[model samples]
Target: MSTLKNEVTAYLGNSSRIAEDWANYINHQDWTLEETIENLRQMNADEDVMVQVLMLDTMQGISTKSSEKTPDDYTVKYDGYYALNKMLSTFGNSENGSDVCITNSFTNYINGILSIGFAVKVQVTGVDGAREERERNG
Candidate 1:
């Protein structure tokens, strides 16, 4: 195994199932393993968090492989840049659950501080608008 692989395994712990994938992903990134690890640490990406992210990546990969099939409820669009920006933002400031307007600071952080090289389309579906009765009550 490579030094990066070994170091990542040690960091994530022996029990991590996705350690190999995580290590490979890190290795392929533009940043060094140390830089990646530092960024992950800043994000508080513990074993559980890393596992969840890896699982999300796996799901996204599966979705891409089966793109010919109709998208099921399990289908997901992976956008790491968007995810990291959201994580860096203050909780509930950027649309946490229901889609809402984003603050200027949030926008600046995502575009300026993060300097993400790519763009992502975040579609919010299933918003049928408030019921007539609910609207009248307001």
Candidate 2:
């Protein structure tokens, strides 16, 4: 059990790092769906993993609605973070040739999350294409 816990911790750490890296990479660039897909591929990530992360991130925004004034709120937030961490574990293992669909889904998901006013300051910058996609579709 201890070993498993340690493994999980390590995995989470790695995922967090990757997420941060991706966020930073897109911080100043105009990201298109194709460009985002290319960046993920450069990171050795698979399509499914990319889609999963996008989905989890979208969900995380929704989960933030819990009042942070209570301990339960913290717990909920932790669980959402954990789910994102778990999704990161599947990165780089998804099937190829689905980047287009995955990118579209990711854009739609992000837009939906934004529409709820849940991720105003959580924008993934530097992806111009992604921003355009969201604007066009939203």
Candidate 3:
């Protein structure tokens, strides 16, 4: 990628400003470049990343979930941050910054120890294909 374009894409990652810019850019008479299009597509992809996880046992499927406060240590496996945040909204009502990401590869421990049932793989997508895809490549 060109330095200028890459820098632009990096700066505009998933930002609403990108949408505005695209709206204006697409309106212009000039034809858009393919590289820019692809870059924009990548920037808006499912950027759901993982937190500190050690082991991941994959069967097949993508499930979304978060753990309730339990007597034992709570682990969270989430599909997307939006879904996870929505589920966690009522439970703890505690303050947690965005860095606390959960992934499907492994079980995630909650901040405190509690009696959690620990249900895994509640994928909003219906199929836990993302986990299977990652596991297959590795």
Candidate 4:
């Protein structure tokens, strides 16, 4: 394995499994606007948290240059960005579960103060490697 891969595995205990678990966890959650906003201030420098953010960025196509993302991927990426900016100013939790809103800051840290000190770099594959790996053992 390459140095980057070895380092990532050492810290994350298996990037593929961490990503799969994250995808499963994220898939089942009802990410409310209030909850997502609150979680942003909870960001930590833990390895697992860093890996989780890496996985999310992979899915959102921020760290990669692939064009294979589904239409929904585009929607989620755009929505997550929108939520980061728009949700903070809005009042009331009335729009928690609304489809028209962006409700996940877990993936929105790209638009926040995410630091380079927590790097867990992975190579960009030609395919939609992020989503494909999740589906393999999801």
Question: For each candidate, how many residue pairs have backbone atoms clashing (under 3 Å)?
Answer: 0, 12, 16, 0
What order do candidates take by lDDT, descending? Answer: 2, 4, 3, 1
Better of 2 and 4 by TM-score: 2
Error of 4 at 37 (Å): 5.7
lDDT: the better of candidates 1 and 4: 4
Would you give me the overall lDDT of model 2?
0.33
Off by over 4 Å in 4: 1-8, 37-138
Model 3 C-alpha lDDT per residue in residues 1-138, reported as the tens digit of each score: 699998855644533243434433333323222222333344444443211111123122221212344533323433443433343332223233111122223333333222212111111111432321011000
Q: Give one digit per residue, the lDDT tens place, for model 1 in 1-138.
A: 699998955744432323333433443445432244344445434432321111212212111111224434213333444654343233223443222221122122111232211111121111353111000000
Candidate 1 Cα lDDT to native: 0.28
- In order, what lDDT does every prediction score? 0.28, 0.33, 0.28, 0.30
Error of 1 at 67 (Å): 47
lDDT tens digits, residue span 1-138, model 2: 999999967865665455455555544466644454445456645332322223223332122122324424311221344433343323323343112111111222321232211111112333332342111010
lDDT tens digits by residue: candidate 4, 1-138: 699988965754443444444334444544432232223224323432322222232233232111243422311232344544243224122333211221233333323333222212222222432321111111
- TM-score each candidate: 0.20, 0.37, 0.16, 0.25
Backbone clashes, candidate 3: 16
Tell me each candidate's RMSD, in Å, in order.
Answer: 19.0, 15.3, 16.8, 16.8
What TM-score should be assigned to candidate 3?
Answer: 0.16
